[model samples]
Target: MALLKEASNLKLITFAAIQERTENFSYGELDASNKPPPIQVKHLNNDRITGSAAQKFCLFRLFPIIFSDMVEHLKSFKIYLILREMLDIILALPQRKSWLPYLETLSINFQCMMLELLPDKATPKVHYATEYTKIIEENGPPLRYWCMRYEGAHLYFKKIAMQSYNFKNIPKTLAQRQQLRQCFLMSKCRFLKSYQEASGNKIIYMHEIDSKVKVLLNHRYGSQFIQSQTLLQCSQLIHNHVIYKQHAVYVYDLEHVEEIPVFFQIIHILKLNQEWIFVVDLLNTDGFSTKLWSYRVSSYDRLDIVSPNNIKYYHKGLDLYKVDHFHVVNLTSRLTKTN
Candidate 1:
């Protein structure tokens, strides 16, 4: 199916009867007003098969042919990454109760790929394979979320300084751009009329959280939390509550010297030592590409939410950069927690 699709797109012609070759086989002779004639062939079998035979034929024969061609074109590096990440996700499959055999098979495939990619003894990346396996065994594959932001940090600096072309005053030009950009970002916090306008006024109350639920609010807003049976003094409320089962939120993220706002989903409400807290999962942005389908909070992972009031919005998307007011719920059903 993939071959047929690619062949159709690429306009590949298979000639069955043309055995003769001439010097005049140029665009003038072969081209018939850009419309190539189709080759006809006789079929061997016309009998239709159903049930298991049909399914086996479709699954083993049809899909394999499609994926085989697709896989053939992929670069070695790309193929390696795909295989590695696939094994990583499999290792991190939350419910690995009866999945030991499957995990072993995937691990074998990953090991085989590693050998193919790094056959020599002097390769540095070969060392990562050991670390990768160890990390997966310890932390259930960390999946793609483990290092996506750290990897993405490399690009942020590149994007910020890509336009610096001053040969004589390269340092001065970069410093000036960085300063101006940061100052402009900080200025947005003082006047959040733009942020408020972009992110609507729909709100969610803290009372919605069950009394037994754990909350983890940021230390910045620790003083605002007042003890009360029915109502709290802080009155935790989030915007656009009705649109999401989980609230889309912004919080301060430390990126180098500047603390910019990052978008995330509030997955759980928690409390420790009388401090109201929110357990948030990070969202993938243009700056960072992640394979996380949704944010799942497990007992193993702890994230302290920053005060929403202290969040400073970036000027790129007016209020929300990368995310719009459009509602998108995280894949919470697939979320799993380990004891």
Candidate 2:
């Protein structure tokens, strides 16, 4: 049965489809991406999924195809919508004061839904979740004060101290070790790996490129680029530490924090004068398909060129799928705007 055309909003799913839920969604470890890292199937399969993994799974993986199970259980689906909106506003740091009121309403609705559907399962954590809006309004974005990064660093030093048995003057030992490591990194020039790297087996030259792309290049760069014998081209781009592959989704426009954002898929990755350019096809921004729990986007024929520097969010790159006649994109993360 097809959706967005047929009467079926909730479709039956296979067991394999359920098993591959987390497997189907994956993202890189770029900072500000706030995406869950690559997880092993065994560790995250079935009962093994709990704690932070469950939260990550709920916020990232589970929502994409949630509509399949929502029709029969409308109350449960209402909870999902509330949580989805909660995530969109909360997890997206730099929480706006204006959105806090709407967040309060979402939280209240979520509480009522939980009480109505599964009151026995509602725990203290749910209570804490309701306070997020108030906390943000009083203390600013919670992510700004998150110690996870610092905790990771501390763990590294803890391992070193434990292995070396350097308890005496631990601070001094840590300082010396860090200094040596810093010197080693500087000497090896590993710190400069932040530069973009073009990946893919095929190498494309200017003449070998599409006529439309050539026109775009000439129109934008003129002879400065047209005179060049060849241009650097690739099917994959690694910039700002995030991996962007051809046809992958990235936010082109975050119109409003409360509204559904617009996305564009990278049609081409080209480089000229040491700057990377992305030729992209904009996704239709009518709104997300609530039944699919994914953004239903009709691909555009007209191509637009954008720069990596001009990207609003550098951290997350989403995946786009061809679902029947239209395309759908599963956003594995929130739209947290950044320079």
Q: Per-prediction TM-score, please? A: 0.30, 0.69
Every model: Cα RMSD to truth: 19.3, 6.7
Per-residue lDDT tens digits for candidate 2, residues 233-274, read 787887766777876778777776564678887888887787
Global Cα lDDT for candidate 1: 0.37
Over the stretch 1-339, how does candidate 1's per-residue lDDT look in tens digits?
A: 222233334544222221111112222211223222221222102122222322322222222222332333433334333443444344343544444455455556655665664454224653454455445565664544555456456455566567554568766776787689789977867444422111222334456744333244423345443342232222233322211213334433434332222456555433334433445556543332122221222122335454334444321111111112222222211123333
lDDT of each: 0.37, 0.65
Candidate 1 at 155: error in angstroms? 3.2
Clashes per candidate (backbone, < 3 Å): 12, 0
> Per-residue lDDT for 125 in model 1?
53
How many residue pairs clash in model 2? 0
Question: Once superposed on the true structure, which residue ranges of model 2 sit more than 4 Å away at CA?
Answer: 1-17, 20-55, 66-74, 147-202, 206-208, 222-229, 235-245, 256-260, 332-339
